[model samples]
Target: MPLHPKIAEILAILPAPPDGPLDPVAMRAGEESQVPPLEQRLPLHAVEDTVAGEVPVRIYTPVEAEAYGLLIYLHGGAFFLGSLDTHDHIARNLAKETGLRVVSVGYRRAPEAAFPAGLEDCYAVVHWAADNGEWLGWNGETLAVVGDSSGGTFVAALTAMAQDAGFDRITHQVLFYPSLDLDFDVDRYASLRENAKGYGLETGILKAFNAFYLDSGADPADPLVSPIKRADLTGLPPALIVTAEYDPMRDEGELYGKRLAEAGVDATVSRYEGAGHGFVQHFSWLPEYHRVYEETAAFLDRRAE
Candidate 1:
């Protein structure tokens, strides 16, 4: 299938790749350029809440009615970059489309915080949301965890941890083009290494991010570091896994979805033929991105009912 016309146009307009080594500052600026201006959008309620100590969150509520469920959203950045502002559109779209309240976490990023630190922050937000459901107008019976890329990695780990600790409150888990495996030997990585126009994820860059996120102290194969390595995929909430045809992480995301299904967990996996890893967040520029949200909202709606 050919790439969507809108996506193709955006790709054409994107500036040529930077000349120097990829540093955090350059990566941050590149990411910011891809995002819409924050002030031009409708404001989400920003709150300072304690999840072990004061953490900030931007909460989006559907205009239709009080939400029947809450989505604790973690933004994607390969564990190193990105912030609440980068994912603001996604959070708002999910809330408005699904009629669910969304609480987007601003977890600590890497180099400053590594490995389990960001994961733990996401977990803390989930715990906090579950504990404060009523006050937040969430039904408690229907709560979910969702993310993309590294954020999806956090969602997978958080789901595993929540299940192991007997926190069964999660109704569904939604992963969009997730980075489920830290190991780089996958065939998809080799096959898509040169795909420059789709989602900007390259094999070399992914390897670098993995090294930074794991640091020197942790093994890359550790299940927490790579959710696909986890032994028990049973007993987690039902999941909806979305992948893109050209994403380097596509195979791993599909494998994780299959693993969940094989473990007897209810899971549905879908791969968009010409889509890329960050499509869900880029819906404003690429019309096809809207389909991802519709699929997610439909899945959540069924789970809620």
Candidate 2:
């Protein structure tokens, strides 16, 4: 299928990335400043900023919901750039569509906090939600975790950790075009070459992102850093893995889903034919973005029931 007309238009208007590496502070500030004031008018019952397990978080509660499941959402920013503010609209939309309380976490970013710290913050927030979600209107046992890009990397690592710790609080995980394998052989994935450019995220920039997120002497082989390297994928929560046809990370995300299914985990893969990475965040301009939310909500609703 051809690219969605609106998506093509968006691509045409997108400014080229900086000539060199982006300053993390400037990138974060620029992204946050452009976030439309869409959260205030979202159909959610309430939106609040609070601390969960010492991690900053934004909670979105739907007006028409009751005793809903809770979702701990981590935003996509290559582990170095995103904040709750950067993904506020995405979180609110999820809350409104799924009737699930969405907790968007602002985990510690990398380069400053580095590897384990950000992952630990996200994991802590989930543990906190499991124990204290009732105060936020969650009366159901159903709990889910979701993320995009690097955030999805966190979801994968958190699931593995929770499973190892015998924590059964999370029932489902949704990963959107996730970078599951830090050591992924780029030459093996054709998309890395075919869609490396003109798709918003280039392969070189992604490599830089990984470098910024990893410690100076960190081993990318660690399962927590690269879940695809894990020897075991069994006993993890059901997963809904999404990918974009033109995304550099598409193959790895799809492969992860296949690995989960092979390990007897319930995993579904949805590839958007005309979409690119981060379409969910660019929902306003991409026609396929709504499908991402609809498919996600349906998956969550089924698991919750």
Candidate 3:
């Protein structure tokens, strides 16, 4: 499908990244400045800023629905820029949509923290949430995770990492247009080449993001870094891998879903046509964007018997 009209309109005027190595501070400030005022934040039952597992997080309680379980949301800025305030609206809306106590993580980014630092924070927060369920309130029957773009990679990796460490508490995972494979040269997917340029998230930006995140000589092919490289996906949590038709990262996410099913893990892949990367957060007004969250809520809404 061709790019959606609204998305195309937005892309037509999209600004290019600075012509040099991105200034993470300036870029972060630029994005954070766009967040609405705290008083202007979308209405929720309650919202609190606190530290979870030594990582900054914002907890959002929905206005009306009883939360099914706790969900840790990892926002995406290609592993470098994005904070609680940058994604506050998305997290609040997700809480409202799914009735899950949503925690948006503000993990340390790179090329400062580099590779495993952010992932470690996310994994720790997941455990922290489980252990602190009592004080956080609403200990529903499940612990789920939802992350988009680069953050989606963390959500997928958490499942594998947790499985190896024998921490099996997570019940569901939702990956929204995740960059699952960072090993760029080997077995490159056509989407990276076909949808390489025009889309808002171009291949160039992806490479730069990967470079910034992995400046510490981390092997991009490591299973934790690229979930697609995981040889064993069996016994991982049930997954909902959402892809955008025109996204450079689209095929890798779908491939991960296919591999998960092959390994006997339940996984569903749904590609939103005419959409590019970050459609879920950047273009929420589109009916198609809403479907991803609907599917996400349905996937994570299980009540324990």
lDDT agreement of model 2 with the native: 0.84
Candidate 2 on 28-64: residue-level lDDT in tens? 8898888777645556678889888689999888775
Candidates 1 and 3 compared by lDDT, better number: 3
State how far residue 236 of model 2 sits from its true place (Å). 0.8
Residue-wise lDDT of candidate 3 within 1-305, one digit each (tens)?
Answer: 79999999989997766787778888888887787787886798889899986899888888645344789999988888777888787898789888888988999888788678999999999999988878777564778989988889899988889999999899899898998899775248988888888878887677777778878555787988888998878899989899998988888899899999999887889889999998987897688687766777888875422
RMSD of each: 2.8, 1.9, 1.9
Using all chains and alpha carbons, the TM-scores for the candidates as numbered come to 0.89, 0.94, 0.95
Pairs of residues at least 3 apart in sequence or in different chains that clash in candidate 2: 45-63
Show where candidate 1 strays beyond 4 Å. 33-35, 42-53, 64-67, 186-199, 216-218
Give residue 85's lDDT in candidate 3 (0 to 100): 81
Model 3 — which ten-residue stretch has the worst lDDT? 61-70
